[model samples]
Target: MQRRDFAAALTAALAAPAVLGATPAHADERSGGGLSRRMRAALAAELDDQDTARTVVPYLQDIGFDWHPETIAPERLDFIVAYGFGNRPPAGGGDPAKVLPEPGPVNEELADTVARIRRRRTVPVYAQWEIARFLESKYRMKNVTSIEPVIAPDGTITYLSTDGVAAQVAEARKHVPGGIGTAGVVGFRDHVKRCVQTTRDRGMTAYAPRGFEMPGTYDPESGQAWTRRRDLYVVHDMAAQWQVLRQKLIAQAYPNG
Candidate 1:
């Protein structure tokens, strides 16, 4: 999908009903209770510290969370809701030693997005995988399921989740042509590893997701190269995760895409 489309789709997914312990969309926005107040303070600090508000605001909105500049009156807001959905990072100091856990069960929205991409004749598997990784980073989510890809007899790929059968494949391709190359996997793994090290260097505790692995190129004596999955370190941090994503876009020359 195009970047705009991807962003919009993600926003819609975020706005979906409370999944993964997210606050419900219908909650009272003006409630200045302890949790809401703390969340508001945290959001205000983030908006003030980073120029990424423009990039993150739409994300917050899409996730069924509400936000505004602190200057706005509470009555003026639709609600003072906030969902820590994107990877913009918390502004106030948090335990740098805290490591987020793996995501659990796939919500309907996320499942639908994955299913849509997987069945599209043109969506690259690598890209689909990248999107999945992005979702994990965007929400810092844990306990989510995985999508499995099966190459068809026609050389087409069909994406399936553990929950059910594959949906109808798209008649046309929906994404740029590319598959996971050995080099791409290795490069991504290295990039993520470096980011993890960088976070640790800054005194933050971080780690690769448990059972994390990546596809790597393997050579046989027959002079053929095949891609294989290899275990890799994958630290999860909003800032560091976003850095990796930015690098991917730059590397692929899609800085504005």
Candidate 2:
């Protein structure tokens, strides 16, 4: 899918009733007790339905799980693509000297994975703008490429979306030996599936390493809290799956447009 088309489809998906209706209500319930018992029950039922749909639908099911290789095999891939999680620039923009923003938890995990892979064998790494700078300056990765952001004429910095990133990787792959090679996508466990799928949508082989997922802790003493957190995470991923499905449908409907 073209970047703008995919972005539009994703925006539509974000505004879809299934996402907007559920997410805000859940957030409100968590903050305070405004919802009545009947309303709460209805919301819970809606979430259950979403979960069931995600489980039964083949395409939705495919992008809802993590893919992990059994061991680190740098030889299997010509390069690595590590995705960042919530590395947006600071509001109002601060120091000019701080070009390399600090890595978030997800980027930290990705950097560690890249470091491990580099230790085994040297391979090129591609990353989003902020994390790319972090890897180059902090990790001192010799062969790092930054998937830069799109700056508008008005000076708005728009980070590359998942589809945009995949498109960039497809373009970069043309320069690789034999015009194609395997790519290992590094990111949060819940996010890895979508990353790999989008990369493959661009006609390149992509996989995720076993580790490097966002860490979750279970507390038996507060089991209800844990369940709520887990359900929230699942619902969020379901929304992302919906976005992916919408992008596919848009591409099919407007193949020439």
Candidate 3:
């Protein structure tokens, strides 16, 4: 191989795509289906069904699996999940399949209670309502809130943070600068700091930013929008930690069910 030839080859290789994030198309590069890997990377299910797709996306993301939806033959749906929880966090890792309430025998009284909730719920959608009720009933959920907001045409914004995770507000700020989700911001860390201060002025702490700068992705199963995720430093205190658990109890528990 002449030096000139090698240089050209190297340049060509550089031009080739860097195997995009850990999708099955690149799964062969590693081995094993452990929890640690799943929590850190999104994975494709082996032996999985298309029906499970309805629940698997959120279940996977709840435990930290960053994924892209894959459509395949139904019979190929059977898959295994590696528990993503670690020491001192929760025994089940970052998943509820290992820690959520089991559908043992619901009391006759509690059964009736669920039927009533099925009728008069106040959530944005049906699935969310059902899941919320289950967590509140079985898990003693408290201090739970949703931060979905709309910025009015006059440029005023509606603020929404319940757990005050601190990081979330930062992320939200990055998503739409000046609390505006319009077509004018570059989503940066500094912008997040202002969001926190603003939230504080309005009598609330804040949620930290985790995936503020990414685009939203679709999950084929549940048909919900999930944010393409990045990492952030989060506080491990009660207001934040327990709230995360409460969410898992409902959303992640039978996530793919």
Candidate 4:
């Protein structure tokens, strides 16, 4: 074909829409909301310190429990509300510790604390696991999960729980066309081990969920890896145990949509 005719045909073909056979028609998706369009395309995924109050003194209320996010101190957060779920009760630090043996007394203390706080007016709270999930789903990192005590600024007592799942993309860099590198499982271990040691180093108490094993950090000490249940850690948390009733008790469990 003549050069002009060939060029015209090529241009027409290039402009065609991609249905059965069409090319791209618009600008590529951009990264947003903690996700690169590519990373988000892959799977879809996609914060603290304090130690002022410890000996969280308690008073006794009759039924439910409550505690100020901080003792004799204010907090940046009002309650551990999820950024996305404006109305739903964000998981983590809502009520007292539930898994304790003979929880009645513990529950009593929590109830009493709430009552005392009520006498004051209101209380603030720190949120937990849901935040983690938000991060994971946002980032799309398949190999990371975090479940930690959502301690109030007081630093001593943890009223709510938080959990998050990590997106574990295997060898994502080597696999993802272009990325940092193949630092997936190996890097994951290095971090987890470091985290476990750090958690112990800071003297954070063992808050692993009941029956579920306290996930060991990647122990170079034993020169071994942890058991494979990254999913359990990623997707679950301590607060999964207590039903909403515990939070509501006599009061309604504050319906969540």
Task: Give the Å error, residue 6, model 1.
Answer: 28
C-alpha-based local distance difference test score of model 3: 0.29
Tell me the TM-score of each prediction against the true structure: 0.20, 0.61, 0.18, 0.16
Model 2: ten consecutive residues of lowest lDDT: 218-227
TM-score top scorer = 2
* Worst ten in a row by lDDT for model 4: 55-64
What's model 2's lDDT at 208?
A: 68
115-226 per-residue lDDT for model 2 (tens digits): 7766765778888765676677678878888888776676565667778988987898788877677787876555556677778888988876544343333223321232
TM-score for model 3?
0.18
By lDDT rank, best first, the candidates go: 2, 1, 3, 4
Output the better candidate (1/4) by TM-score. 1
lDDT of each: 0.30, 0.59, 0.29, 0.24
1 against 3, candidate with superior lDDT: 1
Candidate 3 residues 1-257, lDDT tens each?
34555345434322332443354323323334333233222222331444454445344433222222222222221110000001122334444323322322212122233223323332111111223343457544443222233456764534323223233433544443334221111111222233333334333333322222312221122211121112222122222433555565777668875
TM-score of 1: 0.20
**Which is the better candidate, 1 or 2, if ranked by lDDT?**
2
Ranked candidates (TM-score, high to low): 2, 1, 3, 4
In model 4, which regions exceed 4 Å deviation?
1-32, 36-39, 44-101, 104-109, 122-234, 237-257
- With candidate 2 superimposed using the best TM-score fit, by how many Å does residue 34's alpha carbon deviate from the native? 38
lDDT of 1 by residue, 166-191 (tens): 12111111121442111111112223
